[model samples]
Target chain A: MTRLTRAEAKARTRERLLDAAARVFAQKGLAGASVDEIAEAAGYSIGAVYSNFGGKEQLFVELLQERANDRVNRAAEIIAEAEPAEANGALGRLLVEVADKDADFAPLQAEFWLYAVRNPELMETYAERMREPRRLLTDLVARSVPDAERAGELSSIVIALFQGLVRMRRVDPDSVPDELFGRALRWLFTGAEADEEQP
Target chain B: MTRLTRAEAKARTRERLLDAAARVFAQKGLAGASVDEIAEAAGYSIGAVYSNFGGKEQLFVELLQERANDRVNRAAEIIAEAEPAEANGALGRLLVEVADKDADFAPLQAEFWLYAVRNPELMETYAERMREPRRLLTDLVARSVPDAERAGELSSIVIALFQGLVRMRRVDPDSVPDELFGRALRWLFTGAEADEEQP
Candidate 1:
């Protein structure tokens, strides 16, 4: 095994701690999870967690921000790859596909939001953390849908549907086929007249 | 206080236990919560919990079912109260209003869903519980929307948006206005032509 410098060791510890926190948070939830468990899961001591994250809440905030950025970046890439005309459809397909592949993501997100709501301080940070993603979503919706001004509303609707479907899919996968989200996006962009035309 | 009959006393204990379970589950989450803590919160013995619920998992299932029924029944009542002509708008308004009024319900629902996903044995029952609400929502959408066959898809979309908004609202209330949901419903029924005219 290659030996690591102090800086490299610190970075490695932080990354491992974050990865462990994600798994533990998803499995046990935010409010109910313990930091010692996170440290152990990372094969580190409690002191490592403290030196790296200060505490569990801070760790969670960093995790959430990292995740939010990943989602927005990945979505932007999907939209970028598609032609302007197909960007909206591509966006819808990407959202559904990501949710299908990342089963842990939804529960971890749900736990984060649940913890955020119960703790006002966390909610403020979370709300701020969410701004960029919403802005990106709004811009994409504006470019796709005919009514540009109401893009924010459309974005919210799409996001809300995405989150709701993710929750439903967790308990009832059969009821929430990925095609369902695609149909909703079509309806949003092209109207109900078009939604019925699809199989 | 008036003395209670045996049946009335038993009912009161069960009710208190369920209420306590909701609070405990919300505060500590399902997996982390213990039957002893729920019993203590309800001012009963662990024996009472076992007598009423068989175990923690059973209690959680009962709580989830109760909450789902409460949401559907309340929504049905709201739709029922509205005139047929105004039903769609009224339905959207009602969903938002109910969500705002019962903030705890969303987090609790999220927690329950996370738990359900982790526990495969519970998913079947949870899905079964969800079908009635979805059916009711589909029927309501069919009556209000232009296309009868597409109503189920529309219903799924609306429900997904509602759940997603609830999750988002918990973190960032400012970004996700309750009116957004109302407008989505209006757009679904009347299309973008109607959306542009709304304030």
Candidate 2:
């Protein structure tokens, strides 16, 4: 049998538990998933699940935090790699590709949001976690746009547009074409220029 | 009891069933809700539900169709009433207001979307229904923008932005402000102007 240090074993167990939680939650939904099922899926005992993470809710929150951070980091990398002029197009393409590829993530996210909204305390904490990512995206937008004045609001729109489009695409792929994103970005840029010229 | 034609009685029963469905689906979700509960809530027998709609799936689809039509019509009215110059701003304000005022609508819409994505057959038909509203909005955008070339694409963005912002508001109200919608519209117009001036 493979041997490991005490702390290393504990960390490995936690990782397994989280992986199982995400899969179970995605397949069965937050309410539908149970601690026992997650533990079984993780190949651990019920006691191990409790010892590793206090409960299912904590496990879920951790997963969301990890995902949020991972997404922002990945976005930063994409933005960093793209030429300044092509940054928006690259990001738009990236967002669409991510949304298309991850069938589990979006539904899981929507389910989590629904669950969090019903619990005021959870919602508050989750909302706080969201701020860091939103701030990062806002700063990124300000840098990308020709007019930095409206960057904050425009960034929010871009984020919202990506989310809403992905959601529609999920339900009906034919309606939301990949090229529409580029066109929309161009249109928004044109609008921003007009606004800047106004006396 | 007042005398009524057979068709009128059937219509009344169908309406009541739909009303009950909206309430139940919002509260309990598609999977969580049962046909018996919907019928009981409607104050009709199970047979009335089956006779009127054939099944829960049909009932849900009808509800979606009704909502989709209602939203497009309302949007058209909002656009029609606004002066040409103020159309985009007016639409932005209206979307925000509608999202803020109707708590039930957004959740119900999300739930319906979640339900549709899981069922491929339903998604195809639902997606088809979506195109009409998108076309209507696209035509509206073509008329609103100073530059009509990118209007169709811009319209999709506007729709996605509205949906995404409302969703964020539902989960975390502080992050998505009411005024942000106007600011976004303004930014897009400015960007468009800048594009036009570019050599």
Candidate 3:
């Protein structure tokens, strides 16, 4: 087995704790979860959790930040790699796939979001964390839909649509067909003219 | 006070219980709330709650159903009253206004939604309840956007967009400006060419 250096060991411990936190938070919710439970689940001491994350709320925030960064990076890569015409479709598929795979995480996300919104101090940080994904969407709209006069507003609509669809799909998956995402994206990108060509 | 009919008294009690449930659930979430607490909050006995709604879960579902019905009725009124050219904008304004006025209820709705999503049986009931609003939007889109080939799909997108903007606004009110709703509604109703005339 390869021996880990001090920094690598610390990094591994942090990752494990985050993984454990996600499970604990998802199962019990933010208010119901505790640092001790998270540490125990991660196989670390309570003191280790405090030293690494300061506290439960901090740990939750960090976990969300990491996940958001991962999503934005992956989406950026997908959009960059695809042909312009196919970029939106590829991105939509990626989103639907992620929503399906991360179904369990949605509740945890809604919990933390409510937690942050209820607490004014945390709301700022949560909003800041959300900016990365919004920015990426905005940039994509500007680049791909040059005729879209209000790219920023369109981006907001797109983000809101995706978020809403995810929630709606959780309750009734049949309501939000996977193809719906592509159709919405195409309409937003091209405009009303696309509807005329529909068979 | 005049003597009350039994049916009138029963209706009054049910309304009061629902109001209390909204407050209790909003403050303590669905799992954290109790039948006794809700009953007491409304100045009624636990028996009243059981008789009116059966239990906590049933009360929660009924509360949601009542609220959803009220919203759809109000939206229908708004659409029916507006000029054809202004119907979409009027509906969008009503949505944004309600989102602001009922900001406190958002978290409670989200909590129950999460609760229902996590439980299979509850998911069916919740999805069924959601259909009223979805149907209203579908009908609105079909009437307003004659050229929209996929009226059902457009309605889904519109509902999802409104749901999403409400959530995003809770975390960061400035991010989802009130005017954005109107803009997005116009685009969805009219199509991409609307962007070209932007100043």
Candidate 4:
């Protein structure tokens, strides 16, 4: 067995706890999930949860930060790798693919959002975490759409459209086809003329 | 006061129970709320709730149906009253206005959506209720956007954008301004050129 430094062991434990916390939060919701349950799921004691995260609320906040970072990184990579003309389509397709694969995560995200909204004290932190991803999308819009007026506003619409599709798909998956994301993105960037050209 | 007929009394009781259920469920969430609390909040007995809604789940489904109907009716009225050129902007403004006024209700809607998504059996009925509003938007898009290829798809995008904006506003109200909806709607229907024309 390889020996591990204390820092490495602590990092491993934190990762396990976050993974378990995601599953528990998704299954039982943020308000319903308890520290003890999360700790047990992570194969740790209650003290460990408190030591690492202080409480369930902080744990959730950290988890959200981690997820947001992952999303921003993935989206940045997609934009960087794709040709300038194809970046928006590639990003839209990636979002759709992630939405399909991470279907369970949507509810979890919604749950935490509600939790933060209901508790005003957490809203600032939640909003702060969201800024990075929103900025990234704004940059992408500016880069991809020529003469894109109010690129920030356009980016907000794009974000909302994606979030709304995820919610709609949850209730009626058949209604929100995989192609819808790419199609909608094209329309938003290029407009009705582009859509009319399609068969 | 005039004595009420049995049917009238039952109808009144059902309405009160539903109103109370919305309040309690919004405050406590679906899983955390109970039939007894709802009945107590409405000054009704547990039997009254059971007789009216069968259970908490049924009460929630009915609440969602009522809300969906109310949205569709409001949207229809806005479209009916506005000049053809102004209908989309009016509708978008109404959505933004509602999101501001009914901010608390957003969390409640999200909670029930999460509840429905987590339970498969409830999803079909939930989707069925959603179809009316979706169809209304589709019709509006087809009528308003000349040469609108795939109006159904465009309508879906609009719905998603509205839904997403509501979610975003809950966490970061400042980031998603009221005018953004109308601007985004115009761009979606007309394309980037329309946005660039705006001062």
The candidate scoring highest on lDDT is: 4
Expressed as tens digits, the lDDT of each residue in B10-60 for candidate 3 is 999999999898888877777667889999999999999989877888898
Task: Supply the TM-score for candidate 3.
Answer: 0.83
Alpha carbon deviation, residue B111, candidate 3 (Å): 1.6
CAPRI grade of model 1:
acceptable
Clashes of each: 2, 21, 2, 0
- Supply DockQ values for each candidate: 0.46, 0.50, 0.44, 0.50
Error of 4 at B37 (Å): 4.0
Candidate 1 lDDT over residue span B66-113, tens digit each: 775666656766676678778766866766665677766776777777
Predicted structure 3: lDDT: 0.76
Which pairs of residues collide in model 3? A191-B192, A192-B192
**Interface RMSD (Å), every candidate:** 4.0, 2.5, 3.5, 3.7
Candidate number with the higher DockQ (1 or 2):
2
Off by over 4 Å in 1: A1-3, A31-37, A45-47, A144-148, A191-199, B1-3, B31-37, B40-47, B144-149, B191-199
User: Candidate 3 at A172: error in angstroms?
Assistant: 1.5
Model 4 regions more than 4 Å off: A34-37, A45-51, A145-149, A192-199, B34-36, B45-51, B65-69, B145-149, B192-199
What's model 4's lDDT at B13? 96
Worst 10 residues of 1 chain B by lDDT: B190-199
Task: Encode model 2's per-residue lDDT on B52-100: one tens digit a residue.
Answer: 9869878988897776456656776678778877876787677677777
Please give, as one word, the docking class of candidate 2.
medium
